[model samples]
Target: MLLLVHAALTFMLVGLILMVQWVHYPLFAQVGAATWPAYEREHQNRITFLVGPLMLAELLSAAWLTLHPPPALPSWSVWLGLVLTLLIWVSTALVQSPLHGRLSAAFDARLHRQLVVGNWFRTLVWLLRGGLCLWWLTLLL
Candidate 1:
């Protein structure tokens, strides 16, 4: 049951991550500053609206998996997963949300630069998470 939940959460997060990276970020970059002002709220709404539940589900799944380990994930995998989770928190709190705030406030070149830099953290977080998911999945298989 825990493995099933963990796998489902990982798949869902991967889908969302890909959508944000491949679709939303590019669309956001292309939108001109004038147009971006209007779009910002909707963009923020879409992210928070989708992410909140997904985050909760992920947290729960992580907790469940930690409590009841699947054989595929050894002790090291758990530590790595925990580290990735912490990175997610740090990236969201320190990097992504602040960048989102700046970008949403006023669309400018500086804001764009910040966002682009901020994206690096996002990229790292996703990569780490993807690795963790694969690790867990490998354990399961």
Candidate 2:
């Protein structure tokens, strides 16, 4: 049950990260410069509403699963998932949050590009985590 919930949350997050990477972040440059700050602020606010709880659930569930994995699931795999989740959080805090802060003040072309590029770390991590979940599911079946 815990594994299923964790896998589902990770899968959902994977989908969202992909969309943000390819669709949303790339479009930041299209927002008019005069209003970019406000747009960036609103974007952050709305995305926080959408992602905050899901991220919390993913983090908590992943941590719990690491400590109390199902009998069939290997401890190493759970630990890897937890590590990946931790990497995502660290990347968000260290890399993405600062970029968002700068953008929230004013849009800079280089920073926007960096934001798009830096986000690939998250996108790739989530993709790997999602694949790990699928592998775990197969093991269960």
Candidate 3:
């Protein structure tokens, strides 16, 4: 039951993360030309209103797994999962959040560069997550 719950939550978090990266981030990035200010305003709201709590839920789910631990799951896999989670957190703080903060101020060439560079973080994070998901499935099956 606990495993099922953890699996479900992890899947949910993955879906949300994918949407934010593929949909929200692209939209936010492109909006710089036509409706930069409006996009920036609403983007901030969306992050606060939507992504913030989802991220928290993901962290909480990870924490639950950590505390209880999963049976039959390798210790190395768990450590990798934990490190991936930390990488996401650190990437958000060091890359994404700072870009958003700058976006809130001014839209410029630098912002474009930042967004492009920052996106690598998102991409790498997603790739790591997908790898983790595969490993997770391997554990399950």
Question: What TM-score would every model get versus the actual structure?
Answer: 0.83, 0.98, 0.77
- Angstrom error of the Cα, residue 41, model 2: value is 0.5
As for candidate 1, its clashing pairs are 72-139
TM-score of candidate 3 versus the correct structure, residues matched by position: 0.77
The collision pairs in model 3 are none
Q: What C-alpha lDDT values do all the predictions have?
A: 0.72, 0.95, 0.68
Candidate 1 residue lDDT tens string, 29-134: 7788778877887888878998878777777777666776776578667666666666776778887788788777767776666666666666666667777787
Candidate 3: tens digits of C-alpha lDDT, residues 1-141: 555654555566667667766676665555656678677777778767866776666667666666766777776766666677778888888877777777776667677576765766756665676667567767888
Clashes of each: 1, 0, 0
TM-score of 2: 0.98
List, residue by residue over 1-141, the lDDT tens digit for candidate 2.
888999999999999999999999999999988999899999999999999899999999999998899998989999999999999999999999899998898889999999999999999999999999999999999
| Shift of residue 13 alpha carbon in model 2, Å | 0.4
lDDT, candidate 3, residue 91?
A: 85
